[model samples]
Target: MHDQDRKLLQQMFEAAVHAAEPGAAMRPFLPARPAGRVVVVGAGKGAAQMAAALEELWAGPLEGVVVTRYGFGVATRGIRVLEAAHPVPDAAGVAASEALFAAVEGLGPDDLVIALITGGGSALLAAPVAGLGLADEVALNEVLLSSGAPIGAMNALRRILSRVKGGRLAQAAHPARVVSLIVSDVPGDDPAQVASGPTVPGAGGRAAALAAVEQFGIALPERLGSALEQGEEPPRPDDPGFARDEVHVIASGAKSLEAAGAVARAAGFTPVILSDAIEGEAREVAKVHAAIAREVVLRDRPFARPVAILSGGETTVTLRRTGGRGGRNSAFLLSLALEIEGLDGIAAMAADTDGVDGSEDNAGAFADGTSAARIRAAGVDPAAALARDDAWSAFAAVGDLYVTGPTGTNVNDFRVILIR
Candidate 1:
């Protein structure tokens, strides 16, 4: 029974992820062949795949560069595919950003720049501001990641620190008509928030970025802090630089959840789409989902049995105690397992749509009636693991880690609970 449940959950997850693949989802949204040069540039987990999709559909001559997370690249002709670090910016990304900007150089109003923006683009398009270095930016990113700040807050801080992000990229390509195709990974599908709005106009200014640092108690390096406080603000919505730019969210977490729902319905289960914009600390979100699962199983108040509850959106993890290894999805499943308390007739799966959870090889993990017991039997304490923020180790000990390698796409997290 547990094996059957696992298979069903995995199938649903794959369906959700497959729905967001750039190859299939991005084609219809591709703009018509440009009248002049098409300077293709992009950054994100899915940028390479998005470029591949563009190459397949675009007939006109085009040339450009795109940077993707390490190991996420695919072979493409005409457009250069460069691999770079993710979750944190590295020197390679810095160089790639320079190349991307150069591709748009000397463009006129007749020329077009197709910018592929998606999750992780902020890191992949890492171009530190004039006063800061790559090391300074990396340090700041580390602080923000562990600070448990929401993606929006972290991105606002990033926008202030970057030269290529927060609408500056669009500004640099002035006079060239820019078309951005984005894959949304954040709640609300704010184009400006995704990838720090490289081509889209941004909302917050330096003041907001400073506020995030204070709110999260993030200690900025002295130099970086000074830059944020003293430097000019990033471009705002009314910036004329974005007048010739268009941004489109071609794929998002909501669409992925809908795809999962269809798969659940076909499998004789009623699927309830909880929300595509769910947010909070990873473990806290798990508890809420568990409570809903219990309600359905114990009281049948919200929905009947044989139902699947699906949710998407990114969840943050505040690192309290270090030395624990795990991503948000694995941490969420570990917490969910504890709350369920080995309840019978319930199974759950939590995974990142991008195929790597919290910098680990596993996309996420599965938790069923036997998960907690299995971990305990293996001499691993579930509560202890959660306390250390080490859900990866807990899932690993139980042989439940869901490794999907690189899916070449990212729409944040995908979570589902099945009550039978």
Candidate 2:
């Protein structure tokens, strides 16, 4: 029975992700064959696929390089799609990023530059600011990840310190007509924050970025701290680099949720889409969801039994203790499990649609009312695990963590709560 539930939950989440795939969302926004040079530079899990889609549609000499996660490369006749590391930058990614900047060099104002941006692109674009080595950026990333900062906070810091992020890339291709087609992963689809806003002109300065890091209690390397405080930050909107740019959010959480809701309905369960932009700490978000579910079970308010509550958005996890091995979704699931202890006939799933959550290979976690009790009987304390931000251990203790190698596309996260 649990297997069937798990399968259903996975199907729902998969459908949600597919709905926001770049191919599905990018077709309409593609410009006509440019009269001059047409260069496509993109980064994300979906870049290769998006490139193929664009190549198929345009008959001109479409040439460029796009970096995707390892094993995600697809054959495209014209565009060179390079595979790179995601969530973490590697030497290969750094080299490819350097090559990408070189690829679009020397283009004129008559040229058309198509930039495909999506989730995970921030790390994929590994060109750190001058004087800031790869190790420095990695150290900063580590601090922000453990700080429990929201996606916006993490990205704010990234935009300030990186050379190629936060509109710097677009600025590099200055004089060229730059059009960015983005598959949004951040809440509100703020073009400036998506994938560290490589193409969109960014907000805030070096001081603002440093302030965000400090506000979130994130530590920075000594050198990085001094650089951010002394050196000029990344190109902001005030810079002359903001000359000509157009950014269009091709896919978003709402579209993904609607697609998942359709799948749920097709699977014989009533679907209730809560919101696509839900934001907060993972555990607190889970508690509120549990409260609503309890009402549905007892009072049938807002939604009746046999309905699935769907939501999409990025959630944060403030890590207080170390040794936790889970993403926000699993943390949310474990927290929900503890809150709904002893409650009967309810199920939930929370996962990053990208198929990796909080640096874990697993997509997310799933649990019903008995999830907490089952772990306790197995000599695991879900509360202790959660308090340590070690949700993966707690769920793994009972074989509840959901692992999907790579979905090849990303739109942040998808969560489903079913009451039956």
Off by over 4 Å in 1: none
**Cα error, candidate 2, residue 185 (Å):** 0.8
Q: What's the true lDDT of residue 208 in model 2?
A: 73
Error of 2 at 250 (Å): 1.0
In the range 1-420, model 2's lDDT, one tens digit per residue, is: 167778888888888878877776888888766668999999987788888888877777888999988877888998998887766688777887887899789988788899988788887888877788888867776777667777777777777678788788888888888899988888878878878888887777766777787787777878877777766567768766566677789988888888888888887789998777788899999999999888988899878778989888888887788777888999999998998888887888989887888777788988999999999988899999899988998888888888886776778879898777
Model 2 misplacement above 4 A: 1-4, 238-243, 267-270
Top candidate on lDDT is 1
TM of each candidate vs. truth: 0.98, 0.93
Cα lDDT computed for each candidate against the true fold: 0.88, 0.83
Over the stretch 1-420, how does candidate 1's per-residue lDDT look in tens digits? 278888999998888889888888888777776667889989999899889888988888889999999999999988999989988889998899999889888899888899998898887887888878889878887888888888888878878878888888888887988999999999989999998888886788888888888887887878988888877788888877677678889899999999999998998999999899988899999999999998988899689989999998888898889789988899899999999985889988999988889788999998976788889999999999999999999999978999988887888899999888
Give the distance in Å from residue 100's predicted Cα in candidate 2 to where it truly belongs. Answer: 1.5
- The per-prediction CA RMSD against the true structure, in angstroms, equals 1.2, 2.1
